[model samples]
Target chain A: MTVTDEYLSNNADYAAEFSGPLPLPPSRNVAVLACMDARLDVYRILGLKDGEAHVIRNAGGVVTDDEIRSLAISQRLLGTKEIILIHHTDCGMLTFSDDDFKRGIQDEIGIKPTWSAEAFPDLEEDVRQSLRRIENNPFVTKTESLRGFVFDVATGKLNEVTAS
Target chain B: MTVTDEYLSNNADYAAEFSGPLPLPPSRNVAVLACMDARLDVYRILGLKDGEAHVIRNAGGVVTDDEIRSLAISQRLLGTKEIILIHHTDCGMLTFSDDDFKRGIQDEIGIKPTWSAEAFPDLEEDVRQSLRRIENNPFVTKTESLRGFVFDVATGKLNEVTAS
Candidate 1:
C-alpha cells in the first residue's frame, strides 16, 4: 500500500488490522500542557481524537524544567507552534502544601520526594506564574505561542488566567 | 505593580496570589494529546512546561472525533505546529477487552460505562496502530508535525514506534 493510505483512512483497526506506518502530513501540529486531575477528562471535555495534539500532564498543570525539554523537542524537532496551559479549579493537589503532598506520597508509597512541599496553593496564581515562567524561560519555543487558563472543576468551563 | 516588575523578579506564588479576571497572552500556543496511563508521565518523560503545549488525555490515546475539535481550536485560536504521540507498555487499560472493562466499571463503580471499551492487546502493535490512526485523522492540524513512540514501561525509555 502507498504511504498516503495509512493516515487517510479510518475503516481499519490500527491495532489488529492496519499494517503500514502512517504518512505524516507536511505540517506542524499543536501541543497542550494540562493537569493530571482525574476529573478534568481533557479528552472528553476538549473533544479530541487520536494523533491530533500532544498532551502534557503534571500536578496542577504547572510548568516545570522537564516540561520545557519536551516542549523544546516538540518545537525544534516536531515543529509545534502553540501551547495551552490548562489548570483547573479545586484540584486535589491544590488543597495541600507541597510538603503536605510529599507527606501524602510518603504515606501512600513510602518513598522520599523530590519536589518542593509548598506547591501552588492557588490554582489561578499557579496559572499566572506558569505563564510568565514559560515566557521568560530560555528553553521555551520562542517562535511558538503560549496561553494559560483555569478550568472549573465543577462546571465544564474555562476562565482565562494569563496571556503572553 | 507594573507588568514588568511583577513578572521579572518575583516569579510569584500564583496559587494563592493571583486574582481573578487576569490578563492573557496574545500568542496562540500549540496543543498536544497523549495517554492517561500512569506510567507515561508526559511532562517527566517529554520534558515539557506550562504555556508550551495543550494536552489531551484518554485511555489508549486513541483518536476520537472530539479530539479533532480541540485540535481545531488549537489551530484556529491557538498556534500549534506539531504533535507528539506517546504510548507506554504494561498499561492496565490494555489488560481487558471492552466488554470486561465496561462490566468491571458497572460492577465496581455502579455506573454505566460512558465510553468505548475497545482494548489494545499489545504494546508494539498498539503504538504502530496509533501512528496510523493519527496520521489519517481528518481534524488534525493538516500542517502540523506528528510523531509517535513506544515507551518502555519497565526501562523508562521511548523508542520511535513508527519508523516513517
Candidate 2:
C-alpha cells in the first residue's frame, strides 16, 4: 500500500476519536512559521493544542513572499498577534547553495528557477533575518510579540536566537 | 508573560523526555502541503511519527513558487516521493476574494501587496488546482503518487478530492 493509503487508514482512527470543529480564529492569538523538517513537530514542541495557533511551514522556514502572504492573512483577518519563527539544526537548506541547487536543476531540465532557494549557512543569522523581515514588512503590522528560535534536533530543545 | 514565553516553558518539558536526532531524510518518503489552519494538526491527523514526513504549510494550502521550491527540495534533496495536499473545511480563504483582501490592506496601508492573497471560492476545485499545479510543475519531477484532500473540521475526516 502507498504511505498515503496508510495515512488514510490512520485518519479513520483519528476521526473516530475526534472532537473538533474548533473556532476559526486562533485561540492563543499566535502564528508559528517553522521548517518542514520531518523531525520538528511544532505542535508537541510548543505544547500547542488544536486551534491554538496558526502554523505556517516551508523548506527552511524562511520568510519568502509566500510566508509574508500567510502572515498577512494570519494577523490581518484572523486576529493572530504573536509570531514565532523556527529554524532547526541540520536543515537541508544549509546543505546546499542556491546557485548549485538551481544549476543542478537547470542541468537536468534545461531551465533554471527564478525564485531564491533561500539557503543560509548560518542558522541563527537566518532566524534573525526572518525576524527582521517580519519586523520591517508593511503588511504584517499586528504584532505584540515576535521571536525566533533554532530547534536542536538532538535534544529537541528550542534555543532562542536574538537579533545581532 | 507573552505566549511565546509560555511555549518556551513547554519546550523545556518536551526536551526533558526528548529522543536523539533521527535521520535527516523522511522515513516515509512523503511530503504534506496543508493550510496554515489552527485546527488541523497534520501530524496527528495522519498519525505521523517524528522524522517520517516533511510537512509544508501556508495560507490556503495553495501552490505557489515557494511551494514549488519546497517540493523540489523535498523530492530532490530529501527523497520524498509522495505528495499530499490538504485544505480544510471552514477555511478563511473561502471567506473573501483576493481583490477584497488586497483592497483592505491597501486601505489600511498606502502600499498594497504585490503578491496574490490566493483566496479560493471552492474547496474541492482549489484542491484540484493544487494537485494540477504539482502535476504540471517542471521542478518537482520525482513524484510517485500525488493526491489532494479536503479535511472536514467537524468530523476530522479527510475526504479525498479526485480530479474531475
What is each candidate's DockQ, to 2 decimals? 0.03, 0.94
What are the models' TM-scores? 0.45, 0.99
- Cα error, candidate 2, residue B163 (Å): 1.0
Task: Report the lDDT tens digits of candidate 1 across residue range A47-128.
Answer: 3333345566654566654465445444543456667678876554455455654454466557644534325667777888
On TM-score, the candidate that comes out on top is 2
Off-target runs (Cα >4 Å) in candidate 2 are: none
Compared with the real two-chain complex, what DockQ does model 1 have? 0.03
TM-score of A-chain in each prediction?
0.74, 0.99
CA lDDT of A47 in candidate 1? 39
Q: List model 1 lDDT by residue over B1-164, tens digit each.
A: 32223222222233233334321211224344666543344444443433345565554565544444344434433456566666666554465576764564456547544556436787667766666765665444343566666655545556666644
Clashing pairs in 2: none
Task: Give the per-residue Cα lDDT of candidate 1 at B118.
Answer: 38
Model 2 chain A: lowest-lDDT 10 consecutive positions? A155-164
